[model samples]
Target: MDMKKDYDLLRERAELLKVLGHPVRLCIVRGLLNEGEKNVGDMQECLEIPQSTVSQHLAILKSAGIIDNSRQKTENYYHISSPLAKELIEVLFK
Candidate 1:
């Protein structure tokens, strides 16, 4: 592969890493990975964090395109948005 193309891909990966750098965001991602789709309340309960804090981290993850949300009744469900995120989280445990 071309070095330029490799560098570009690495840069993009770095951007992703930066987005996932926050402890709260990492915990949110890990929760989503383990539980599949979950609402903000569910994450808050599982992580033992404040609801607003959970929402803040979820928003960050959503903005980074690392997770997607769907509305079910009065609750919003979230799940991993990209296979790359799943892979990276998996690698973190290995």
Candidate 2:
């Protein structure tokens, strides 16, 4: 493989890992993998954390391309987007 391509891949992996390094973010990603897709309210209830806190983490994960979200009316539902995240969650949770 080309050096530039390898560097870009490594950078992306590092960025994803960095974003998931937080406990809240890890939990959110794991939850998303297991639950399919969920809105902030569902995550807040499951995590027992404030909605704002969950939303903040969700934003980071989404920005990293590790997660994706869709809007239904006013509710935003988030789910895992990266296969690496899903694989990691499976390994960690199982």
Candidate 3:
């Protein structure tokens, strides 16, 4: 086994876990998975958190490639983009 390759894979997985470890981020990810695609307004309302807070968590998830968004007119609808994240959320809720 190539130690460097293994280490790189571990690091990537660790980073994904770290990104999902936050309560707000976890909620956002889970919400996206369960509710399909949603915009900042929708998530803010569901989470009962400030729009800014939701956007901040979204930025983190987006940076980690855990979620991706599509633009429809004026709003951006976000959805889960990582299969690993989807499975993790399902296991967590189960």
Candidate 4:
């Protein structure tokens, strides 16, 4: 096997898992999977966390390509983007 290529991919997966290691991020991912698409306001309400905190966690998930958002007028609705995250969410939460 190509060690470098495998290591690179594993490194990326590890980083994504690392980003998900936080409790808030874990709940946010699980929430998106369970609740479907939502905006920062919806996440804030459901997670019972500050808007800024939710946004920060959302940013991390977005950067890791675990979730994505769509703009509808003034609101940005986010949803799970990575199939791996989706699968992990289902397996871990279910």
TM, every model: 0.89, 0.87, 0.96, 0.93
Which residue pairs collide in model 4, if any?
A: none
Over 4 Å off, model 2: none
Model 1, global lDDT: 0.89
**All candidates' lDDT scores?**
0.89, 0.89, 0.96, 0.91
Question: What is the C-alpha lDDT profile of model 1 across 1-94, one tens digit per residue?
Answer: 7999999999989989998898888888888898789998888888898999889888888888899999999989999987998899999966
Model 2 lDDT, residue 2, Cα: 100
Residue-level lDDT tens digits of model 2 in 1-94: 6999999999988887788889999988887887789999999999999999988988898888899988999998898889988897798889
Off by over 4 Å in 1: 1-4
Candidate with best lDDT = 3
Candidate 3 global lDDT: 0.96
Candidate 2: worst-modelled 10 consecutive residues by lDDT: 27-36
Give me candidate 3's TM-score against the actual structure.
0.96
lDDT score for residue 54 of model 1: 89
What is the C-alpha local distance difference test score of candidate 4? 0.91
**lDDT for each residue of candidate 3 in 1-94, tens digit (9 for 90 to 100):** 9999999999999999999999999999999988899999999999999999999999999999999999999999999999999999999999
Top candidate (TM-score): 3
**Tens-place lDDT digits, model 4, residues 24-72:** 9999889888879999998899889899999999999999999999999
lDDT of 1 at 73: 93
